[model samples]
Target: MMKIFGKVAAIVAGSALVATAAFAEDRKSYPAPKDHPLSEIISGYEFRTPETRALQDDDFENPAYILLDLGAELWSTADGAAGKSCASCHGDAAESMKGIGASFPKWSKERNKAITVEQQINICREEQMQADTWKWTKDPNMLGMTIFVKNQSRGMPIVLDNSPEMETVRKLGEEVYYTRYGQLDMSCANCHEDYYGNYIRADMLSQGQINGFPTYRLKWNGVGSTHRRFKGCMKNIRANPFKPQGEEFTALEAYMMYRAVGLPIETPSVRN
Candidate 1:
């Protein structure tokens, strides 16, 4: 992993040298909705090195496919008291799960709160499959299945819930995004919004988009969820991170998704 990251670091450093000349060319920004804060929205992919982008572009080359394959197998394998697999109820994922990834961090009327795709997966396990819920950040199966499910919706534009309840959640997320936290006294907007396209150490700041989540980050040497990245960012700021799948994170996800509106899903995206 160190060897791979070393190569990536070298490439990133080289890319940074010409970054000023290519800044506008490299960024792929879209016109934001009239109500959105920024005039344009940029995907995290824009900040990645060419090699990392190439990895995400090729399905076979993407390391995340290893976990995605496991998720596909698990989709058809029955378990728990019900002995029913995801395939049994959902039929083929390509058909049943299509366009589903873009509508995540949805409002749950039953729960009276917003829930992420990870939370929904656990809900299915406990309620539909009669199986124990997978650990949020610990279980490889959780991350694998998420990547698989979201990958089914690759290329679809994000379309989040806009109900009154969801609006409340989105507002909460907006608050979290702007609020300064930790010993560093920095908010998410400080880096992603204020310093985007600028090099911070060796890494280029992005718009903090979550559309490409369950992303395969080279820094991690593996695929990880948006929440995992969130915790890492909090740690970087010397802040106490929120627990995965918690209300705060769910709200934050909703806000990020809202920010990424109209951006195509790029699950299992490779990033450095």
Candidate 2:
């Protein structure tokens, strides 16, 4: 991912160099050195304090485990107009959902669109269970159910499909991440991509990888989905945010996940 970041920085640096040609000796903010040390690790977890890491490693101590339990119960709870449980169609999530999370933000040929795992859960809820779609941030179960399913793929490397449509979606994601918005004139790339190791006041900025979500945040005292996090980021940036789980955010989520291609799955994780 740093290689990609390096490429982006080089372009920006080159442009600046051209604009200030006369200040050849005084030009500043060169592209990140090719050998930036932090580039080697993708997940922000590697950057967390040891105490934070320990919080995630211990399942019993992890606040997210509480949500995971909630997810498990809802998996078998009858719901919707049809009053069917998830177990009705898909038995034992451990068996049925192995590596499922690692393969999502994918093109669902049946649905004819790309979907996150959260969306897949809603599809099953609406189609098979005849239920209403879960609201992104409002529905607590949405995050938990996603965490329960994603935990099955723990430690697995993320893998995405290489279909043509997916390639197009990836481009859209790239556009969104790089496009500056809000009064600050910042893009996702500006903070996470360009200055990942930098700090903002008391908060340490991270690469903002999603392998950890539906993660337990000490801030929220809860597990939340990527879209929830995205909503927060948007609000902070002063951008008019898209609806969570909406198509635009889904595209951005897919791109972010793709950027984290080789990272291990660490759902139910703890982060600052």
TM-scores, all models, native as reference? 0.91, 0.83
C-alpha lDDT (0 to 100) for residue 196 of candidate 1? 83
lDDT of 1 by residue, 80-199 (tens): 889989998999999999988999888888998888889988898889999988888747899999999999999999997889999999999999999999999999999988888888
Model 1 stretches astray by more than 4 angstroms = 1-21
Q: Can you list the residue pairs that collide in candidate 1? A: none
The numbered model that scores best in lDDT is: 1
Checking candidate 2 for backbone clashes, the offending pairs are: none
Which consecutive 10 residues in model 1 have the weakest lDDT in total?
Answer: 17-26
Give the best candidate by TM-score: 1
In angstroms, the error of model 1 at 258 is 0.6
| CA lDDT of each prediction against the hidden true structure | 0.89, 0.81
Global lDDT for candidate 2? Answer: 0.81
Q: Native-vs-model 1 lDDT?
A: 0.89
Cα lDDT tens digits for candidate 2, 128-199: 899988876747888788988999899897777789988788779878888988877778988887776556
The TM-score of candidate 1 is: 0.91
